[model samples]
Target: MTEESSDFKFNYFFGLVNLVAVFLIVWFLWYIFMNPNTVMKLYTPMYGFSLIVVFLSGIILMAKVLKWPAWYNRLFQKDKPITKGILLTIIAFLLMIGLNYIVFWGFIGKFGIAYFSPDSIVASGGIGAEPFVARENASTAIVYFFTAFLWMALFWDLGFGRWPWQNDTYGVQAWSKLFAILFFVVLFYILLFHSHVCYLFYPAQDKAAVTPWWEELAGTGSAFFSLGLILCTLVWIVFSDLLWEGKPWNRYEVDGESTFGKGFVVFFSTLTFGIILIFILLMIFNYVWMEPFVGGQYTDGPDWRYIHAGEIAGFFILAAFIWKNYFNNFPNLDSLWLRALIRSIIAVVLGLLIYWFYYSPLATFFLAKVEGFAQPGDTPLVWALLFLSIILVQSEFFDGWPLKRKK
Candidate 1:
């Protein structure tokens, strides 16, 4: 809004670059529309490298400008570090919603114009459809949340003269917590719109504390993949922070400084990653037999293959969480082998729990009910695929005749 702010784009030169990119995209589209062969050919790592720099720079800039909580919240209330962010986000969401309403509902309502119909938004370049309104809103909201979350963490670490949260030093841990919160804020927008595909679920039988609620919640395959985005970001952030600090690992030992768990989590999860093959097999049968087997009011997963997939995926997820919590992030324990043992055990336990809880019910639901009373498969191939997957994950051994071996 200010002259300097506009010129600086808060702190990013990429605002100019983004504008240029937009112009280029439009031109490219126009060119393609006019002539099939007209196209911009950009082939170099540098092109990608430049975009990365632009992206990071824009994040920094937007943080400076849009950081209402970081600036205004700090001034008004000294307590509750996240208050500023939460309040600012609520206001922003309401405003975006209101604007959409005004454009579609208010002005259009009064004028009765075709331009204001939900269809009009689609025709004029808004997100399409009744269902996709949520998807589009969520998608746009993701961009907004990422800008806010990543920027807040970026600035706070810079402001506090501390490393980013990923560094895990005691001083910067506060920022890490804030960073995690911000990441979840991104999830909020993601789930608000597309709660269906998240693959979250609850137990149909109910009241079993051991039951995985996340599976129930993931019913429609709307698996809060947004959370996966944030988690992946954190994984990279941690890696980058280590790289920046001349440390190869995110965590350091107590007696001295050493990095132990570099590829452990990745390898550990991968050991059990073979579940996918089984899931695909069951999915085929789920479509074939589930409706005939289990004829009940199931939501989007009428076939039950997806439901079973949700169950099995839950295992890897549980193992990942456990490996993260108890071992990769162990307390009072700091040896590679020890961490490995703890993680592997936790992972197996989590894995078994997933098998017992989700896969079992889903299998029964799909295989037994066959549209009238039962559902999913009778093929040895599907079971064989899954059996092989378990071995693949357990061995944590994946290499290829033409490929590199997994660590």
Candidate 2:
């Protein structure tokens, strides 16, 4: 076999092995910490842990986006991939904890925004005043913050392809991108999330934020609409970047370089695609669960429907990542259209399977979730994000480790 063929075979084999490994790790971690069947039995800690993992992902992505800073190089420049992965994972964990407890909860939460601190939330009273409920809501609000950050981070990385920063050094590029992304993330969070969160309390913090603008159209004042929309956007972003090899978008280049105009087009194009994708998914769910009525609970609730659509999209995103990184994104073929079509179908099928299995009795047995679909205070996105974070850590921090055959 040619060296290329040999490499493909090698990756295809170990990729399956890695998939199984990741599945077990996800289950074990869930059981140990987040499982409702176990001591935790609450969604607050689950969301908190999910935030940490996603924060870890942001840090890891930042390292790569910046092309590895001098500090990172000095620390891990000589270490093996596995060792580097271990050390970085530990550091990421600690850093997230500090950021959560010290930065958000301790400082900003205590002195500035009460929403970031569960204690403050509870003391204030109103809706979700119970300790567990308050903490869960606080963590979820923060999760939304990070989720927006992740979306912007990936958008700049893949959609922009280092534009505007192309001529800058790593440090300059890193800070510029980080601050710019943060500006948008914070803006989006305030507009999209803060209002909904403000209303989650009793009497509603009408003074803190304006009434949710989408409440009239969406039938609820929940941020799930934003969450679902963003996650759907992510699905197309990943689909374009990985399965299509950045085609169509990359083809918009000028003189062999990615241009700001092209990147702007990419931004709005994927967003439009995301809107279409979400509505399609919602239609599918409508067929499955019947049309969701306003104020109805579970699968029948509009809020749940929107958020669940996002959760399902999260599965598609994970499947796309897994397909690219682990499965060699199989069916390497000559006809580009045919290859893309088959891969899209495969990824959707895989995502559907994941969605099914997550809501199935098996997940309840393993993950200790409530029976049936769209259970209150339970979200599959947390699990999906956790799984994706592991895959990212393996690829970014570990350098593909055991999966990367010796060059």
Q: How many clashes show up per model?
A: 46, 1
Q: Write the per-residue lDDT of candidate 2 for residues 99-199, one digit (tens) a residue.
A: 77787778877899998888888888766888887777678777777778777877776677667777877678777877887899899899889998888
Error of 2 at 152 (Å): 0.8
Q: Which stretches of candidate 1 lie over 4 Å from their true place?
A: 1-79, 82-311, 322-332, 351-407
In Å, residue 296's CA in model 1 sits off its true spot by 16
lDDT of each: 0.34, 0.78
**Cα deviation in Å at residue 295, candidate 1?**
16
lDDT, candidate 1, 1-407, per-residue tens:
21222222121243334333433443443243322234432112122112222233233322322333345534675344345434543454354455345533456423653323334434445324343453333233333344334433432332232323335654355445455545654454444322332211221212212232344433423232233323323323322231123122324332333223333432233223333434453556556555323333433243344334433443544344323322222322435445445544555465666455333555344222123221222211122122222222221111110111112
Measured with C-alpha atoms, the lDDT of residue 182 in candidate 2 is 83
lDDT of 2: 0.78
Error of 2 at 200 (Å): 0.6
lDDT of 1 at 137: 32
| Model 2 CA lDDT for position 217 | 83
